[model samples]
Target: MFNRRNFCQASVLACGAFAVASSHLANAAAVMAKVGQPLTEVAHLDWLCNAVGLTSTGRLFVGLPRWPGFENTPSIAEVLPNGTLKPFPGGDWNEWEPGKPNAKALVKINTIHIFDDDTLWAIDQGEDAGPHGINPGQKILQFDTRNGKLLRSITLAPAVLPAGANLNDLRLDSGHAYLTDSGLGAIIVVNLATGVSVRRLADHPSTKMSPERRPIGEEGRPLQMPDGSDHQVHSDPIEISPDGKWLYYQPLSGPLWRVPTEALRDTQMSEKALGDTVEFVYDTGPLTGTAIDSAGNLYLAEYDRPRITVLSPDGSLRVVAEDPKLWNPDAMIISNTRELYIPVPQSARMAANRGPGGVDGLVRPFKIYKLQLPALYGNRETVPALVGKPLA
Candidate 1:
């Protein structure tokens, strides 16, 4: 019963719809292809590095952990504009021998952070050549980036640092510094002015690796310890909210957590009361390093995948960048200009992962990659109020 004109009109409408659909599909493919295209290599080093930090002025610093194979290398280095690694604060600070005094040298530097005030803070895990343990060498060092001068060195007391305590990362407020003990599952709160420290939420379920959340390596398999058991890392990643009111932290195998800064600063708060204050924030999968933007967004280094995911303030998560070369992106930092510096140390390829080739499986010239953040995060001018202020 259809007329020729009506049939022709219907065909025209169908063709128009088809064209629109095709355009949308093509646009989507372009976006997917661009996801990781912005990732650029910032530096490449022969030694393994686990952490990176950026100052407000755009200077970059990296931490070289004294791992089994990298014992003779410098513990900390500044990446020059020419892409050369120079021992930072130079001289004896980078020299640590087996029999020498550990107090004067950098031993097993785990993480480094550069504050807006242009001060660099480095955490020494204190394990010289033995299993993870507490020693007189466990310390947090503050250096003036302008002159490469040592400002303050705070040694963690054995009373606060237990036998298996592996001080992993640090975040600072105006008056205090917070650290994570990965090996023993605790938060060590240090008074910045007095150097006094107290262990908080010790063995708390929130700090401990979840019994169900087994860590997975970049190879898409559960990471195992040398004993053939599931590899476990307790509290490892930690960050302070831009406003300095909340602290976000979690185990390497995570469900992200947060607690109020006021509660953490309270020395008299009972362990049970402090534990009660910890709030479950998000169910972040296995991640290594975390950085917070002025927008209160958390940028996470996905430990099991080759991507960086940002967790918004409202609890939504999205992958901001992805690349095949982002192997085990450890600790990351967001610069004032809204660029993220990611260090891919390939910890999964290390000897502990039990790969087919042991340490030989590691790729040489460990890379530190960077990505310009999306415009949605905004730059320093947009978030000027918190740009150079004390995080807390």
Candidate 2:
């Protein structure tokens, strides 16, 4: 006869097995209450959460990079209202094993954005730097937000992404997409229709990180690499204007720059001509992610001071929100509800592959927060104007 002790032990084992088998939907249901005012804690993740995006309907999507420990975790997930993370566009697209066939896998999602057309777009960084060298898996993906249906998957040309390239943030405008490669210090422009892409501003002053720049830690100290040198991230922030005419961007440490959309699409234009189109906007001291409003105002996630700054269309900078709880705000999205959603990953504190220090380890249960915007802010409830000619 089975004793009570044995029964309890077996029951516990059964529950453990169930949880492991259903890891795909783990921690997505538990609700963690708000931590602070204005900055309400949204979904909490034990893994390294990088960026968050919201659809026009207010659906939440979050991305997890394949860092050291979370190699096989879902690269992209939909955070339900109940706070559970379900693989977006579902199925085995997010599942991958080393030796198995991962042809359709979302290996590592560096950043994701929901566009005006109700489509979700992402930059899959592909491979991380293993002990050997840079792993290679970069690709661009597009999906329908309504049903998680994948619309497009375009593998980037090797010429666009060199050996050290780390595909970072992306912004969609008109019919084209602009992507920043932080590791290689360049900007890539892609024609969505034909999937043709070209690398731009490679080694251009605008794309390179400020030589003396270093991200500050939560304790108000300069972040340093293991070697004691200043830590840095290259061209990581890119945002398109509400009119789709201008593209503003800069490195992690920056003096911001802007260029006309026409200049990026003109493949035949000489390098000097393209460079001439770029204008020195302003010096954004220390920033991570950015978003733009229809009124042409740019919202910046200013990391050092830990606040959101609005760069007005007339070239004035003003603080939008300043809260002590805002630590290392990464990717930001302006929702149709006139709210800016910021995901505070505290990425710099987390430990990288080597050990603690840069990317060492921060407080767990990473959070996403939203700050309301004024009613006059241009909200993209419907699809924005798709300007410029479609690809041939």
Candidate 3:
């Protein structure tokens, strides 16, 4: 149910144990109340648990990659608050380019983001991967949820294609967007109004920390690859400043990196000049997913030791809440009321397909823990942003 391009993204994130950078909170803490039912039912998908995005009305969208030797399977699916599950009609997580609107392209959508109107923007991630694991190259498409119709596809022009680039995660500031190229290592910019895109930080060290040099594992050990070796780290999840100043990002497998959004959009400046503008934000060991709350607190899916941790606004940090139950938490969304909705995307089966040392999927069962935060679960009665969306 998960597809592997034989592309090793180093496959790990908030899937295993929990690591805390602060000793103020108890080391072995529990935040999960474990009271809710499976948030929704996914069909023909053992990979639904990977990447997740939710709309204002509580409509949940998910992405799936080809798992095992399979190439064509349902890749994208949606679930209602009431537990109804269905494919996104035209969303597909498999092929490089999304299936055309008229067919069953509904299965290949990946890397999803929901806008203010809850309009769904899904990244095709190039249904197929070329050299360096780059998919349909890098493209973004906007679809109308009111009818699952293919609205528009945002393709980066040849001027923006810098070597092997795959559009990774992104965040919006005003009407502009900042994105990461996990494949060849680059930070990208897109003007929402002009549809103009630019590729920057083509090889910035901060954006491409060779996985070899990152900190060792919790026990001071190293991450093991299928060959019993450690792969170099790369780029991933990013967030744009609400004020539109700084853009925050990190490797799906490295500490966080931040760069000036304006510096990237500047066509006049050379990449060398832009690289000089990058700043090191968090030294998070590794994460499967990253999210920044309206409060400016950053959430990371700690991969090595699975748990969702937060970087407070003041820079102080702590393990928000972690449990094996949290699983391989990938892309996540925070509701208007501060309740965190995590989409635990399964990655084990994905790893195994690459070779060994990775496990398989049992559809990566999940349970959404609705709780108040000090990073942990408290019985708070705030109206969750997604509460309006019917889960029934």
Candidate 4:
């Protein structure tokens, strides 16, 4: 039932997506091309959306979303090169620190990278603080990747967090960093050394609105089903280029945007200056997620589509892979060889088997799959083919 060809066909539907299909994969191939079979389906998370990252120490880490849907699910996973999925050591899904506020769930993991020796920063969207739908939510927790030790928990400064701000994905600079407040629709800046942070572009037009916000028909018109229902999607997966020259991001719906890293980090610059540098990179009707290659290319997973397209460093678009199996291709990691590893989400399928929160009412068995085809997977140095073991 889950094969590469199903992925290919699924991509066609997503790209041509007017609506998410309710039909089984076996009956869908005639409409789209299928790629190779899913290398494996990872069922460790409660629900998997944007939980993806390839760390420097030859490991791949995945963040899991736990909650009403993902009850008793894993909070983090390390995909070992041997293709096994193992629990992240920091916080056991069942254990919360003594006298601490109740840990609700895992929303999304921004990205995993070695911030310093033996230390890795795991940005968790604690829980969408603004609206009930904000999601996987805003806690920025740090850990020692070496042995899964809890190092620190970074909180939003009162100065930076207006009440009801939900932090999204995060990107790190040498000594500074940036995070997106999808709940509040703001860009948060943090000084790593002092942990002093500030929020900017709270409602910047670049980050919030998009013509791509709505799904488009294959003919480029707003696509909808015969029933006259609409598919509404927003927020997203984002990444800063390797050299930190450009920040490329897109909300779920479309119209990917970017601004020069210099402009974004130039805290001293006027708002007009920062806004001046923010540019509309390109528009896709609806995209599932995006990843940046070391060479400065961005690979976007078209939400309902099969192909993973690239926004070249030079501001051009190219199709990196047109495989059929990339259905619901969501977050991705680019290894050193430029091979892209995407976690094609099967939430729709799992949702079918389990109910809303999934089987057992816990959204059990959420799957994040990996694919290796033409492109860098991310500065590859024998990182696990998939991160299944704890960081050594």
Model 2: lDDT to the true structure: 0.69
Clashing pairs in 1: none
What digit string (tens of lDDT, one per residue) describes model 3 on residues 125-207? Answer: 55445444434434676666666766666778655654466666766665666777766777778887788888777766767
Error of 2 at 313 (Å): 1.3
Top candidate by lDDT: 1
lDDT of 4 by residue, 1-392 (tens): 10111111113222222423332222233366443323444434434544565555557777654533454445577767676667776354324332334344334444454432434566665544434442323567666666776656676755676665566667666666777665546677787777778776665675563443455322133333233433333345667767666666656565666667676666797776676666666655467567665556566776445656666545455555545445556667655444556665543333333323333312334455555544332443221111224344
Shift in Å, residue 204, candidate 2: 1.3
- Cα TM-score per model: 0.85, 0.82, 0.75, 0.70
| lDDT tens per residue, model 1, 1-392 | 10112111111011111211122123223322234326888999988989887776667888999876789979999989998888988888899877778787898899998876767889987754234555558888888777778878887777788777778899887778899988879998998777788988885787899768878765556666556677678999998887788888899888788877888889988877877777777766788888888888788887776767777766556667766777679888877767888999888777766433344468989999888887777442122221245332
For residue 327, give model 1's deviation from the true position in Å: 1.5
Report the CA-based lDDT of candidate 1 relative to the real structure: 0.75
lDDT, model 4, position 231:
36
lDDT of 2 at 236: 84
Query: To one decimal, what is the Cα RMSD in angstroms of model 1 from the true structure?
Result: 11.1
Candidate numbers, best TM-score first, in rank order = 1, 2, 3, 4
Q: Residue 304 lDDT in model 2?
A: 60
Quantify all predictions' global Cα lDDT against the true fold. 0.75, 0.69, 0.57, 0.53
